[model samples]
Target: MIVAPPDPVVLAGLATTRPGPAGASLLRAGLHARRLLLLKTLLVRVQRHRETVAPAVLRGFEAGWLLLERAERARPDVVRAVLDYPTTGAWLAAALTEPLGPGLDRHLAHLELLAVTAALRAGVEVDLVVDTPGGVLPLPGVGRVESGGAGRLRIDARSRAVRIGGGDGTGSRAVLRRRANGPARTLTGSGPGWRGLRALPGGATRLEDLDPYRLPPDMGIPARAAADHADTDHAGWADRWTAARRLLRGTDRERAIEVGRSVDAVVPLVPRGTRAIGATLSAAPGAVLMTPSAGAADMAETLVHELHHSKLATLHELVPLHRPHPPGRAAPTYRVGWRTDARPVAGVLQGVYAHLALADLWHRAARGSRAPGLPERWRVRSAQRFDHVHDQVVEALAILLESDELTNEGREFARQMRKHLASLSSGRRALA
Candidate 1:
């Protein structure tokens, strides 16, 4: 029988040292776990006929860190086994319940947040490895004990690069690198990746890679025509609108404008959309919604990161629609995501995904402007180093589909995104 999330009894007093093994016993306690495996097989089968979950593009992730956080607490052993060897504190942090106390616990939140935040900040790799023999198991999402495979990740904050081992035994990988410490840096990658495996019976592993420090070809797309549609938040918006309109046109033009709107509307959802772009809920619901924006573009990029929460909400629990927290639990903070203008050389070098892509984009854009290949292009090139800042929403949007944390769309949208991004940023690789 497949084990469900940790028992509240066991969970209330889980060990700090060994969570993985301990969590496995909870599975034995459940009577219908075997049925769940059967259900997974049937559901995956249904996807072959129809679609699985939602399209990855419209959403950012199939699961979010918070959802994973709760599941981990329910099953400590599964987490320990799948996550490799986390520290006692790390495991405790991973097993921590949403604090229903009066206030947010930065210390406890730090552990779980650091696990994911640091992974993204440092570029830790994460992916699924499905095992159909046992049933259909998503990597890191479930453990072998439950018939679903566990996640295999190599986290190195010092190296600033996260490599997902893919719990399903797939070789898919995603990476983020930085060029400096600036806000809104490059986020190069394979774009979105394909779902499940190809028809090898085992499956095809499609990984999107990111090379943040590179620039895509400049296809003479004008950027100034959209000045009329620019958000009137600040002078920077006027400049970026006028500047981008002066440089880009056609598909790039339209995409840029849409991207611009998403980033510019990232005000808090309680306020129901801010100066930033879009706002979507995470598993925690209500308090946190993604808002991706940049100073020049507002908080659109910030909204993108927040939106990831909405996309990955399902992983919060295996059961349906049960709130992850009690009525009084603290909500996931918007601070979980961010954007920057400078490069994140140290972050990537330190192995963090935080603003790593933006950093790489900024550095590359800067270098491209200095290149002798072009004979004094437009003045915009001089400030192009921070171009990634303007596109944070784009990255956020792609993550819903492309990122391992959430696989919302199918391959078709994933491929389209790859082609579009590949065409834009001077041959930068995908986040695949």
Candidate 2:
């Protein structure tokens, strides 16, 4: 259960809307190659509706899309990882029912590609059974399928014998999780636990059945809001939640459990066209605020990123990572490869540490190759990308150590980071 800080005011700037397309911002800001592909997806969505899209939206989306297209062709693996994702369906459903005005620059766009990568690792598969009238819908990896009931779609997972569809009283939307395996039971949702492997949270039977009271307060994510709750009926949000929680269990169960236990609460950020898909507050420890992600992989990584913050927050109480910037000497700033924004030493440290975990995650992902149909070339490329991130982190660590920010403990921590990086590098070299 999440504990509340007394009189916790909602974090300000909860709704910062940038006018341009979210994809363009990603390109201009410079994102990792894996993420760049996701920006292109948002652009693709814009192009499909160019005639109807607003000028700012079309211009930004097209500019970013064209830039990426000219520089590189969209990889088949990247595309398949995306379009075939379960959350992509939920995101599309949300966009259709809830209109958020012009300039559809939601961070959720990036989540699509991230989900693709994560779901593949989870060993989870699904087939979208849609009820459409006319032509066969081309769903990249899944191929063409026919449907009759115009706006209705059903998601089925044969492996788990689980199906999510309309029948649980959400009207056109299917938020209820009906276990079709043995006896029929309509579960609201579940959390991080994997049955038998780990115990579920108290009172929670299904993974998608989240404890609303355990939700954090500062980040603006609603805990109690659901399909039945007015103003909280976020179309496909319920389904998206189910997919994210399940993916976490399937792909990164241990880490998910760690996060659930450490973090006080998660605040779901409404998409406001910002480049950041997720964020954690230094002021408000254990609180993570984020937009809906593209898929399970995206959610998994986002959890990793924010949970790193939670860990660091706990450590910060004990040891300082950096000394305060000298009074009046323009605070030192450095470029974070993940973002276009320049960050101070503290911010950079935060990013570097989080990315250290991500780098390692991808490194392990590259080595094992558990995901079916993942290409060899893509694996090599991913390994190279994460190695590059590791190198950057090492560099950042060096620069930080040189500065006078070390309490004996901080220096030791920095050394440990370097030691870990060196070990990972050596292991990769041996593999090569």
Candidate 3:
């Protein structure tokens, strides 16, 4: 689980919010390595806190850890997939943040569930006991098993078949079938206790995650709310995503490929009118929470914008973009033109970087007729959007350049952004 810093050229390209496929792949690899390292650190912490952890929980943790190592040795790719799942990161963050108590126990127990998922995917034998907090066993990137009560859940995986039994005296039993190469499929000939993970129709992108543990606690989106929002019109959501990807690929094939590489899962959010709301968590590198929109162009822009945040978040992990906050002093805040309230330097940087991409997106769309399906009204509006977001990005970049909170790498990144913005402005003027 060795991680390396991004190449200087890659950093510069990412600063411009246009890391090509190669750069994006590099970032993805670095982020994946970081996640694997975090998993190891978490396991070490669990071991140190064994005294506080219940005896049963401690034994379960040890078993899961051993199984994880075995699966990693047998099928590294399958184990890596389980490690890179967005929920895995969220679970790691939760487990690390929780104190030594029942809260810690509850979160640490998720590692066993993750191990079970990896074992099932790797085709390794698994006979493990995991805590089912609310009568639910969530296999990240796979589906969930819902028993009627909360207690321990027994999972046994042999060959390509898995048997799940409720350990809470409910006598609940369900069986799941797994593929020889891919993720575990939906229940086959099993009792009525679980549902499969639904995927939206995007050629190479996984567009939806309905898992209860999809989001971290700090994200403020309750599992029930996300589940409710995901329940309606998955076909409609798939149609909009297909249209959006088509529009993006038509406009810029490189960027469409980059988006598919950077974004692994889309957590659907409740929409607000015609506007699409979106958010990216720093801890979750490849996941974006976005509201579904019927407008293809709007969805395309949201995807690019959120992808910028995801990339920047991953980049910051390897490179110290901002200076550490002073021990007792509050971090200084700035007023970026896009947001109403003042924000810290990191937030400002994220906004500027994302908007820079949006500005470029609209700039190209405003000038070119490559995407014939783009609405004429949107084409007309592209100029206005370009000017508005372009100015906002310029203003935000100025703040970042002037701030003392940025490290040398951060300053260089901002300068590279300035260069990109200048190029975009020159292109706009040439069209004018």
Candidate 4:
């Protein structure tokens, strides 16, 4: 028989996964992608639309809770540390698979883990010190907010408490096992063994104190990231496309849908003919990466870039693509390149191609450029044309140098990124 009631907060989450009218309508409004639909219709309630959405997000999470439970049993340490928040349920589900066989992919889980580690540190504190179910814990203050530190989070001022969506600091963590000891690791690396994780400097997660709708333990994201995450072109790339769609009203709707199609189209493209991914692309059939979330034409770039690899695979006749490299310590499930030279800028070149292609789309659609015929206007519009390219360029350059970076050119990149993002920020600026 079962021992406990699966945590009241978690139970409550299960009960409320059904999105009410507002959520359903929002889901209906932005069904561009099924995953996007999940984010919008289901995730928003858990992360953002608390009053109207808590029930639904929780319900979805709860429905998915068994996955978390299994993770606890299998790799308790990994899942506990990685799948710490409700937003992470999807990731948890994805991560649960053995991943060594065919039809196994942990891309979303990998990305989510990277993101949530920062989120946990943010909500808890950089040098956070607090109490936990295990014992006293101390979280080293990430000290400052940077790209790695969750680039200026979006905070909830009214509650006087900081939080990330699905992260309430109050929800119970699905601990598989509590190891006795270890040196210490940050929340990102912290696993079921609380040995290395910190308590952070706040009151306890208050797991028992939460209302049915209140955030569960470990639910809080840091207070520093009070601002929203902007995309390569300064577009408001909130976690979910539903939020993006809400903001993408009026003229942007068609464009947003077009972007969705553009991004989604890549999935089928790569899966079709992936015999040659190594000569040029290096990545494999499942190795292709994408981020049509915000800023830049990342969607098209990957479609084009990886497609280049797919054709490369065909050229070389490499059956299953493989490149064992990623950002984390584990075998690299992902790979990114950095620009060694700022001049003849390779990143800039890519940015140009991406922008020009999207520009072609814009022209073909006959959507007049906003505020054309100006110096800065040209610069900004140009950035939007290849938001993905520019975003990647700046990010790559930053990695390459990694010292007092963000030079004038980098600033220029940021400036244009911000503008293009702003154009999409209101969410009302969809394609023509």
Least well predicted 10-residue stretch by lDDT in candidate 2: 10-19
The better candidate by TM-score, 1 or 4, is 4
TM-score of 4: 0.21
Per-residue lDDT over 1-432 for candidate 3, one digit per residue giving the tens place of the 0 to 100 score? 224555788788887787576667777787788897887788788767778998877887888888899989978888887888776787788788888899888777777787888888788888756778787887777677776675777777766778888664346467887777654322343665665565656543554454666665445534323535336567777888888888777767778877776677888876556767878778887787887775888788888988888888887877879988989998899997888899999999999888888887777777765467766666667788887778788888999999999989899999999999999898776433
Runs in model 4 lying further than 4 Å from the true structure? 1-86, 89-253, 258-432
lDDT of 1 by residue, 1-432 (tens): 223443443432111111233333442222123223432443343235333223431122223344345444544443333232112222232223324222112222222322343233323343322222222212211111122233233222234443333454345344434222332112233212312211111111111011110111131122111111123233343343344333322212332332332221212211223444333322121112222233432332232233223222321233221222336855331111243433222111111122332333333434454444322433243235245333653454344343332222222323433444444456333210
Q: Which ranges of candidate 1 are over 4 A from the true structure?
A: 1-280, 283-294, 298-300, 303-413, 425-432
Sort order, TM-score high to low? 3, 2, 4, 1
Considering summed lDDT, which 10 consecutive residues are worst modelled in model 1? 205-214
The TM-score values for the models, in the order shown, are: 0.20, 0.44, 0.91, 0.21
RMSD (Cα, Å) for all candidates, in order, is: 23.3, 19.8, 2.9, 21.4
Judged by lDDT, which candidate is best? 3
Clashes of each: 135, 16, 0, 77
- Residue 380 in model 1: shift from native, Å? 5.9
Model 2 CA deviation exceeding 4 Å by range: 1-253, 274-276, 326-329, 371-385, 429-432
